[model samples]
Target: MHLANAPSARRFTGKSNRQARTLAATLVMLLGLSQLAPSVHAQEGLAGSVKRGGVIRYGHFQEPACLFGGWVQQWYLQRQYSDNLVARNEDGKILPWLAESWTISDDKKVYTFEIKPNVKFTDGSALDAQAIADNINGWLSNDPDLRNPTAAPYLGESFESARAIAPLRLEVKLKVPFQPLLNVFAQSSQGILSPSALKRGLAVNCENPVGSGPFIVDKWHHGREVTFRRNPEYNSAPATARHQGPAYVDGISWKFLPDQTVRYGSLIAGETDAIYDIPAVAWKDANFRFPVLRHLTGDPPLRLALYTARPPFDDVLVRRAFAYSTDRKAAVDTSFLGSLPSRATVR
Candidate 1:
């Protein structure tokens, strides 16, 4: 959650390890303090004590293909309309969402979940163990017609079955011990779907989705924007949520602006409260105004694949040379404006 540091502007020069460590520590402290200073002001300022009900106009690079959350990989918009079975806190610990609690068998092959009672989808349908089972097991279904192509890739190949043993109880039996099962369940693509919506098939469900999350899709202007309204009935914010009640905003108006300049302009004009995918070059100009939050990890968002079984890449020397030839530090400095975590490993 650290903001961009102003002092990291100087280019690195393969200096002493002690100097590098000292500079890194200073950058982290400054970045953290930058965010902390504003936060303290906001909390004590008039803005913090004001009553809620304003709509947040958020701008992003792209729009989701559809509203069905459980099938899309990079569909960031879907998360507003749906909730995952579990969630991870800032510290990376798993927490309860739709399922209030769960237990794993000693063998680690069986997962039993206790579904939160009286939870209802936006369509007024109750969220029971059966609905949860259908949403999960649906991904594992091998039936050519019933299987979800987009969701299938996210599910583990060893998935066996998911069933409802009681009204508020669900059992997921795996073929093998899946240690990452909880992590998988925490993904937005594994967000629970309304059973009734699933029965209508993917086409109808994607276009018109119903979930028990904090917000419901109010309108979707194809290729433009999607409007969401807060669900008054939404009482179940995951245990890891920042707060226990509904969202502070009345609703959220998501605008899709692919052009980085236009997005920045919109933010500057105060037309949008937040904007994502801010360009590295824009950081200097953006510093006078809004805060820029970047990912703190070193993992590359994308990778260039080389076929080892093929001719050129098959040679270990060539592969090693290719990897060595790549200027990772320069790329990171130029692309991320030198804000990329220094500790991040380049794969």
Candidate 2:
């Protein structure tokens, strides 16, 4: 997806001139990195320091993720390194990406996409209408009993069939009119992959991905790091803010640093350029010295999935009692530093 402006551009100034000055300085640093850093240079300056050419280590709170595990994180990672037909904005609006534009039939059951021309996968394979159809078919093959189980919940409302109409066009027939079908196409699972890549097997392709995103996977050393480089064949320049060419950073290194303390230390010591999932305690230090971007949960309040189909959680009374007896406030205070607000839910 094309970021209209760098993250630094959205800074909010306050009545406090001192705070504004600090934020302005940090924004300058971020802009410098996003501008002066060449597309081939591995090392990028950040926060007014010359950091080394190395991976930006990350500390995930769970076990190593399966690349094709059909999980949200996996999907997120895939989408990060791949492109979808449609893209979603922060406001949940649909925007065109691979598919430049689309039209829906009067009945809303038939959707036609005008595919972008001259798009090529990292593997040098031509990304045409057939390639998109093949990728969808591959996703459909995952279920034993269903024709398109991978797309069931998403396309079930409208999807009847998908077909490639021409070299740069494709059509989908739906069972009914689904207003949010474009939103479904924007999902990561619906990300388009090359036909040849799928033939090599999902597990194998995960280790070595080939996509039309701004970056392409170069190396993935299981538990160590995953390296990515710009896709020279990427043709989404018109849709992105950096319309001149590919990403500013020549490459990106993602190190698997499990220790939060060490990760924070690395960022502070200039050993790493940036770190994700920063803990609450680290926020104070980061605010004072470094640029920090905290992702606070918003309304619709990020849902948590529970196995209600199982025995223990199957009982309604038990669920209600668990909800009533749970010390949510204490849990939030202890775990999330009371930063997370409480929300009312019904059993």
Candidate 3:
């Protein structure tokens, strides 16, 4: 796929996509998706005098069982109510969030993070080193209710334990070198939750998982939607964040519309301010109306899965021919997320 403003064609993979999506969601909440608080028509009509403190109704495709979980959709809600140990930039570089600074051992197994002081969860619990340690251990635990499936592969067998060396220092011990440790910590699934709220158990916590983010999960109306209110005392934004205070919007009504057409339609009809994913068919059209925020997830440009054990794929020459024949630019142009204009048929 070809990304960026006038870029080269390259292979693409969906890996680390959750991070980009989380960033996109964060962008919506933070920047208010470029004055995201107001209605589309209101912002357009009012111009410079942008309205403030209006609840944004966002449309999405899927709804997870709870707020925080392994599924990509779950990560969406998690990002709203949670803050990670660290943050990542547009260029895929790691930045400080809850952790102000860190040092790595020569072996790279132990990561000592300096937790930012005075950070607190919406539930009025302090987010200290011990709090982060509890979150880390929760991710590595055997309990399904707490274990972060998104972080499981990165932690693996080598992840030993997370301990509080001091009130503001956290020591994460690993059995082997895991270079992607910091990057993985930035994922939404790894977002730090309040230990106090977690103690209430999954049944209650899933609907109202506490975090130190910009917003708080107010209530979930079953299969229909989930509502979020701005965290009034919020102050712990990542180093990369532009707005360090509460979210500009009053609250968010995140609606679940599984059908792609219906979801995009909601955005068009002025019922929703934003949607999870822009549909491929509506990509070209949606850009004309809304300020479509495209996130260039810095992974491989493309990744092709070949069942090489069978038939044509089994032959190396056939695989080589297939690679060369792929219309990379056209592939990018035709997809919803791609930068170029759609012209060619999807492969």
Candidate 4:
């Protein structure tokens, strides 16, 4: 689809900041979809019976930039070792995770969060408000040599500073009243850390990472795979968490499989429990057992671009004709091998 913003085609209209923000949020929700498939326990007809002890073998196409620091574009991988202050439910509602509760000021420029107590990082350091403040300060720092390069984009102009007002309370001040700041807090990029590790600096965390997440980084075999062991002491699952108490699996090993064919082969051969971004051919293959797939439409995909300044595309009538002539369903079936959700369910 052509997203033309030319003066003649589509002019910019002034909107109240709040209204604009609401519109942007609505668009974001309509664009994204998330899905996860979990392994079923052997026990039947049990409500709270969670069988634990096996390591979940997972396959990914790419390796994360840093074990603890850098952000991965994909959601299925980044969350293994990081725990954000908050989490988002299936309906896009924000819920508390590391922080037990939070309060916003009348002007909405300030946020005070009461962090959950007794939480410890993988390195056995307490996860207090001080550690969270340090993370924010590091992200929003102006020093070229002391800032987290991956976190700069999210900090932007909205974030002012995050400080610890109490041992378990954090106050975050923003430049403007941004409603999406809550959502941003729930993202993997805002994962909390151990204060001691932050003192050790970012480099050590990259290799020997520490977080208040469900898993701990046990080993990293460079380009091959990363091994994680479940945190036995973890009991602070979010309200929206799928399972109660500790993780169902004993641990998870994320294997890097750049080749789709090899990944699919591993899955079929019982070498791996699950895989990500399987090729279209393998996705449609009937031979695969217990296969699962999820499609993400978190942004308006670029299909065909038409320059409005050009002769044919400049005419509104020509554009309308092209849009009417295009079969979107057929395009979805052909281009994505019917793996993509229909436009109506894109949200």
Which candidate tops TM-score?
3
| lDDT tens digits, residue span 26-106, model 3 | 234432222122123333332333335767677777789888887777877888888889887756788888999999999
- Model 4 earns a TM-score of 0.77
Q: List where candidate 1 sits over 4 angstroms from the true fold.
A: 1-47, 69-74, 142-151, 154-156, 297-327, 342-347
Tens-place lDDT digits, model 1, residues 40-138: 222223223423566667666766676654443234555666777877655668888888999999999999999888888888888999988888877
TM-score of each: 0.77, 0.71, 0.78, 0.77
lDDT sort, best first: 3, 1, 4, 2
Local accuracy of candidate 2 as per-residue lDDT tens digits, 1-347: 01011111111111122222122222221222221122222121222323323223333323344443355555544553566777665466666777888888888888898888888888888888788777665555544321333466666555677779999898877788888878776666566776787677646776776666656878877877767765655675323222325544455555666787776676666555555555656555566665444433232432234467886768877676767776654544455443344342333
Q: By summed lDDT, which 10 consecutive residues of candidate 1 come out lowest? A: 29-38
Give model 1's clash tally: 0
Top of the candidates by lDDT: 3
Per-candidate Cα RMSD to the true structure, in Å, reads 9.3, 8.4, 6.9, 10.7
Q: Candidate 1 has what TM-score?
A: 0.77
Pairs with steric clashes in candidate 2: 39-250, 158-175
lDDT of 2: 0.54
Candidate 4 lDDT over residue span 114-206, tens digit each: 999988887887788988888778767875323655567766678888999999999999898888887877766567767677666556766
Q: Could you tell which candidate, 1 or 3, scores higher by TM-score? A: 3
